[model samples]
Target: MNASSPIGIFDSGIGGLTVAHAVTRLLPNENIIYFGDTAHLPYGDKSSAAIQAYSIKICNVLLQQKCKVILIACNSASAAAYELVKEYVGSKAKVINVIDPVIDYIDHHYRGKTVGLIGTKQTVNSNIYRKKTDALGKDIVLKSLATPLLAPMIEEGFFNNNISESIIYQYLANEELSGIEALILGCTHYPLIKSQIDSFYKENITILDTSEIVAAALKKYLSQSSLLNNLNAYIRHFYVSDYTQSFERSTQIFFGEQIRLEHYPLWE
Candidate 1:
């Protein structure tokens, strides 16, 4: 809750690094402690209770590291665990979820327009994006499709390849996502293949990526709370519940550099 404390961010896997990169760019002086639940990759298929349990453990690890704020960077985790984590953290730390900021963005910018969303099964099943956006009374029409394959594909370093392109085409070609004014890249991993998705529509639709939105939101939150760090104190730390060379590789893909990941095996 102070200016010098590190910001915490966690995701099911390396997808959240996209958010981490954005945060680093936006607040160059602030430190970050990132946790990737590599042990529980593809949280989109897990039960609500399981996701919450994993999220709480990750949040506690961040708290133990003296983080002042926690960002749930995974869409599935945000949908399943945000409220519980918010309540658990209480006043110990501030909590931010990826969904709210994107919903707010749509409410402000795309009102009265049909917006398409593609995400993991848990995210689409939770219906959080649709419910929140619709409740805004902005006359926003939401059409969502569960994109269960993209996350794992991105995690496995399938981006910028023909295998990735074919998968992206299959998902976007679905009739459910057709003819929308905009498409929400509802998973953090989606940004990694943004060009492939963007190529599908040929600039016919606005592709909303939450990495920048969430980063801007964190910057604003820190500024409003008078917790902006002005010193040359930026430090980056990456942790994972489990480790593999693939996770290391994907981390490089997202962050554009190899970060030495410390294994913080939560269940062991």
Candidate 2:
């Protein structure tokens, strides 16, 4: 639990880079080691068991890197594997998930109102948001929509263009999203299009994205635990199970810098 230890963050793919970027901005002195399971990506469509297996593999790599804390930056992975990772990591490192922070944000800010949730099929089908909201006794109506296309579309570089807009409109304009005061961008990849989604709704509804929320949560935890890094030189390492030009492109897009990404193939 030393301050110099890097924070580990992982997602199914480059989507988790959103959280990694936010963490860097909020805690500039903390080193980070991010792993993207690009080979088994789009975990949203996969079964819970499969997601857990992938998550365990990623966490093991993160632990081997000597990370002091682990952040599950993908919604689908968080939904399926947060508890498992938490249990597995135990006291060796803290485990944070993108899902709980957003849920807590909604519970505190949007209580008694209708909140819309959008994520991949596995996440929505898991009914995690509704279950968590209910467990917290938050008196809000939780409406969930399985948006299985946005991640792949964004991965293919369709973001912020006419094609992206058309797909976003088709999903957000659905009847199921009506009457909600706030919409939860359940996927980490969704923040890349946060402005588009906001514009589509004309800023009438609040869009909750996990990047800032999770970053803030991590900062608070680090501060309270006295684990804040004091060094000025921060190192960031990026790894992917499978390497591709598209992932490198998306990493730069989300991280806002051309970073050298390393390949660490987990499956043979």
Best by lDDT: 1
Q: Write the per-residue lDDT of candidate 1 for residues 142-186, one digit (tens) a residue.
A: 999999999998888888999999989998999998779999999
lDDT for 192 (candidate 1): 91
CA lDDT scores, all candidates in order:
0.92, 0.91
Top candidate when judged by TM-score against the true structure: 1
TM-score of 1: 0.98
The list of candidate 2 runs beyond 4 A from truth reads: none
Instruction: Give the alpha carbon lDDT tens digit for every residue of 65-127 in model 2.
Output: 889999999999988999998998899899999988887788789878999999999889989
lDDT of prediction 1: 0.92
**Clashing residue pairs in candidate 2 (N, C-alpha, C atoms within 3 angstroms):** none
Backbone clash total for model 2 is 0
In order of appearance, the predictions have TM-scores of 0.98, 0.98
